[model samples]
Target: MTTASLRALLSHLIDYAGLFPPAAVDLPTAIKNYQRDRATGDAWMLGAFVLPISRARDVPATLADTAASLPLSLLVGPDDLPPPDLQVVSVEAKTNDPAVVRQLVERWQPAMVFIELNPADEREVMWATLRELGAGAKIRTGGVTADAFPAPETVVNFIVRAADWRVPFKATAGLHHPIRAVHRLTYDIHSPQGVMHGFLNVFLAAAFAWHGMSPDNVERVLAEEDVANFQFTDAGVSWHCQTLTTEAIRAARREFCRSYGSCSFDEPRADLRALGLLR
Candidate 1:
């Protein structure tokens, strides 16, 4: 595929999470930004607005008045569920216990549920449980502290596990840029700094895995830091000698990797433009 086609493969790949940390704007401000972005020419690159389930009622009347309903992805507590009118597309819950997830499924009957796994726990049972229930996975790629970033091996294992189970997943936190780089963890003036995983790295790794690339090679792709190491064409994207076809990327995106949650849409757009990936 050509570069243009490759870009198209990533359409609606980012779920706006502006209400969360770092870009934690108030509900009205976040709604205003989402409304503005949805009106832009690049709106195809945007996905659902993410918010806590408890705040579903606070969605402003202005957004409700719009002709098109806003899609939402809610982060729900074990006991919480969104109101029926919110048009929630998916629900996310953080629980290592399979029992809690089962209860959530039984109660809410969400169209999609993303289970955030506990890194310290052995996830085979949980993954199997989720698979049986037809739920998806979610990984926290980074946080405010340097210690929050999981090792490359851990993320690689996650990709492999999800693929092995035939489950799709999405990532959240600390993936504001298109490429891997050292950056401050937050908007705080004295924020801690760490090497964050790049969105390109994660999605490309997922695509490569989908195409049957070895796990070791996928980890290498995830750890790639030099921008020149990657080449994007209409046919697909290449990292050094390995290439994943645009068709494969589209498939992985739709069925395996899904979309990631991002707090700042503008930052990602600007970074992509700076890298000449976006016009």
Candidate 2:
């Protein structure tokens, strides 16, 4: 891709990154120069693609038939078809009593699977289930808010271990915002359970798990006056390892927190608010 096109795509990253809630511009906005953008040869552009949620049974087939140029995955619910290219998963949804998840994975054999982590069982049961599913299967694990909340450290640990097992992973949901600690003294009194913070709270949790860093060390990092310290390199950013400028890295840290930050979809502007990009 031309530098200009790359700049445009990266601009979208910043624009989306700044919003409290991650907003979807038209798919075209994500890919105006499809071929060039794809060829830009930047780490940020490497795994970048659209993730669509589908309800129809034929969604996978339809995606395979159309949108061949773009890589897409389905957030499945009652859609019965061989896992085409991408599949969304959670521990309970896949490994539940009937083993529907196992059946699907073995059958469709999608390119990747996003596994949601459950905190209730300390995530051991969930990881054991995936191990039982076999190592040859290409799968990635992720966590959702309902399964845990704020951050799912257990799920993050599973993802790291899964990597050691040759399983690659990525995350979604409850992660649409940037890093920051939240402590509304009033919220504690009103909620009585605990205070709910932003997605950054959870992202740091995952970073801590991935690095095998002590929770105490993580707390120290979190407690630091600067949130930028939490942005470290990962497999996703390995390609452009040399060129990752300080500003770019800082921007990435901010975007990571923003994209995964705390927000809800009761309104379309949730992501916008979390990023402080919207009024």
Candidate 3:
């Protein structure tokens, strides 16, 4: 990906503020929306499935057949074993036993393995089991979804762990907008607890974990509080400079919705606000 392309795509992966339909929209419609707003870039566009395992098991044969026809990378719940044409399978770490997990990996060999980093006991076992699976088998990553309460520090530590293990993973939930800001309104606990801020998380992950940057140095970048600072070109040059937190990113999303009338990448910068949806 070119520097500009990488920066542009990362912006979308970080926020995902563009799609503004009511929550009750059907899956097909959501998929269509994504199709309409599709961005043409080398950076991967990770798509998600809202269906639970049982329901997904009954996916229309036509949908399954059409899945491989789609452009972006698709992800279905672990519980739901959609056809391989559907792309990645994100099995909930808790729902499946290790043997089951192992079987799924051996059977599908998906692009990624998503686990929810939970209680100390489970977390330890899950981490080790995943490590045993080894690299090139599948990309392994964890997250704290809306249904669970995970300390942000632990979440950050987990990212560090993944990096240490050379695991290239992405996250979702609570990260709705990106950034370390507090939601004083006590929004729906059913939703994921997003990062305190996108700028901080990206800077921390890149500087400290991915690039071996020091904490102090990352803190300095956070002091400036710019997402753009962390977004560098494939060539390592700066393009489309701007910094953003989860809140600011959300605010930007509101603006984007007003301007574009819908959430697709129809509006490039506006669409980028949805980057946080990566998780």
Candidate 4:
């Protein structure tokens, strides 16, 4: 049975990205996987489908087999606005300056916008701008190479700062596992392996950060690779010395850390099941 804390922490946590690399599936395959996955008990953990804004028009013609309104988080670029026909809930794009974000949103706005930032170089000003614009932040946690993974310090900083700024955030890439450990980076048999960040670690750390935990403790939560380090009860979640109530987790999920994207929904779900977090 999933605990109340687990449900609060994990509800709608994964935004599916079957169209992206390593799992670079076709539109029909992605749609089919999404539909099939939603039919299972695990659907509670599912979120939006990630697609390029340019492909917004194709969603309709290809979605004839499925039910209506597949929520989409468009991977956007260069003045691209989603067409009126699609259910474009949010858009994700890279930007260092808030002015660029403001200008883009002024042209056409989605319900949510996540702007990726270089937390190291961009100071508090960047996050302040996001807060002012009523938008969220985005972080790229990993890629195909070992170097693609940012140091743990970078991720922790992003989480804490986003919390401090009262900005919601989402993560993409390299967070397909439930725990942080050395894993193959790609689907190919001989794929290069690296220590990837776990989605649980990242999101739970965000929850604590949102609740005003110290940065050192937040990093501790992120760095923990042992499943034993975490204890989820019906009332709260315990990580070492700190614990957050289910209500705290729900508030964080609603306001601070929204969701993350993964190329395979099944992999994360299966990992959660193996850990006995799901039944």
Candidate 5:
């Protein structure tokens, strides 16, 4: 694909989740960093600032002087409600029950509702409910250990299911780099290390699945660790023998895999540059 196409595919793909996990900075620090990212040249790649619903009230006061407003994605519970002025673009709720999801959606009336489901939950029922409600899904792709990373098959299944059901979804946790590799789980020097999913791997798989790629192919794409097998062009990205057109990728990005939350935006940017995908 052309550079323009690649840019379009990735536009606003990473939701800033600085308040979560390894980077867990204070609200003030997270706000400062988000503001800096918004002011940078690559700001177009940044999405909403994510924070807990309980902390929503603190955001306006904390960022009062620094940023005029923030596009937010609140991590909310089933009954939590964001303040009217929070400017929430989307909401992530931790619930496997469709009834609770329905209630939250009816009350908050967000642009998007990302409901997290248990791995063993009746996924079909949950996805069907989301489809009926016109909501979305959220997946936790990684955590602090090797065991935290879901199997490649699990992720691929989620993508295929969402594509089949036409349920848009977003991912959070452990996707800080552009490619899959063993990396430190946290910023601390003594932090544990594990194999983390690549943002590229997950999203590209979603695109391919959205275009009807077979489950095996999607799994291969997710497991791809060799950068040489993947090619980036002005028109679109190619993995091994499979190629996704720019238009297809853009459509998948828009309608299927919305975005992933990351604690550190700089890490993904740096990895992209090192791979020569960025200047």
Candidate 6:
């Protein structure tokens, strides 16, 4: 059974994006995978279906006709404004400019809007802007190539800024495992490998940051690839010398770092089991 700290830090933590590269599976196949995911008891960790606005027309009605109405997170390009007819619970776009983010919030008032920014960019001021506007920040942790992964310092910087401003944020790409490690970047047999940031490192960094850990200490957590350093208990999560109570982890997970997008839900689950994080 998963401990309280694990549950607190990981509820609805993965927004499946099977439609995006490196999985980049066809729509029908992606839908099938999501349907199968929803059938599992582990579905509680799943979030929305990541559907690109361009593929809005290709979605089958069966995608939403499940026991619970499926949540859809539409990925929009800079110029791709979604039509009013499309139904989605959230909209995601990349832009460091707060104006474009404001436009998204205006266009989709009720639905949650997350605006992506480069972690190395001036995210502190941008996060403050998002906080005042009631919008969320998004960061890409990794891509298809090794350089696609941002440095540990930048990621920790983002977490500090986002937490300081109380701006909610979500991560995308490169985080397919539960711990920081060198891993294959894609499903292809010859896929290039890189040092991918673990979901635990990122989210735990956020949780600890939200609870007032120093950025230096948080950076230590972010850079840690050793599984022995992390201890999950009924009361809280500990990373080396630092610890966050279960409630602190829960609050951060809910109000700050919301979730990460993944192309394969199974990869994360399998990795977590391999780490003995799951029984």
TM per candidate: 0.94, 0.46, 0.56, 0.96, 0.95, 0.93
Against the unseen true structure, what C-alpha lDDT does each candidate score?
0.84, 0.35, 0.39, 0.88, 0.86, 0.85
Judging by lDDT against the true structure, name the best candidate: 4
Off by over 4 Å in 4: 59-68
Where does the lowest 10-residue lDDT sum fall in candidate 2? 12-21
Which has the higher TM-score value, candidate number 3 or candidate number 5? 5
- The per-residue C-alpha lDDT of model 3 at residue 65 equals 55
Residue 6 shift from truth in candidate 4, angstroms: 0.8
> How badly does each model clash, as a count of residue pairs?
8, 27, 35, 0, 7, 0
Quote the positional error of residue 235 for candidate 2 in Å.
14
Which pairs clash in the backbone of model 6? none
lDDT of 2 by residue, 1-279 (tens): 223322322232311111122343344333343334455433242333433343223335534443445443434333455343433321112233225546655644543444443333344444555556641211221223232233434444443454344333334433333443333222124522322333344434334334444554444433343333433332122111112333443443332311221112222134434444233
- Candidate 4 local accuracy as lDDT? 0.88
TM-score of 3: 0.56
Provide the lowest-lDDT 10-residue window in model 5.
Answer: 59-68
TM-score: model 1 vs. ground truth:
0.94
Summarize candidate 6's per-residue lDDT along 1-279 as a digit string, tens digits: 999999888899999999888999998798889889989988888998888887876666664354125578988866776555655788898888877777778887788889888765764667777888888888889999998899998899888888888889999999899889898888888998889999999999999898899999999989898988999999998877788899989889888989999999999999888888876
Candidate 5 backbone collisions, by pair? 1-233, 1-234, 1-235, 1-236, 2-234, 2-235, 3-234
Runs in model 6 with CA error above 4 Å? 60-68, 78-87, 123-125
What TM-score quantifies how close candidate 2 is to the native fold? 0.46
Model 1, position 242: C-alpha lDDT score? 91
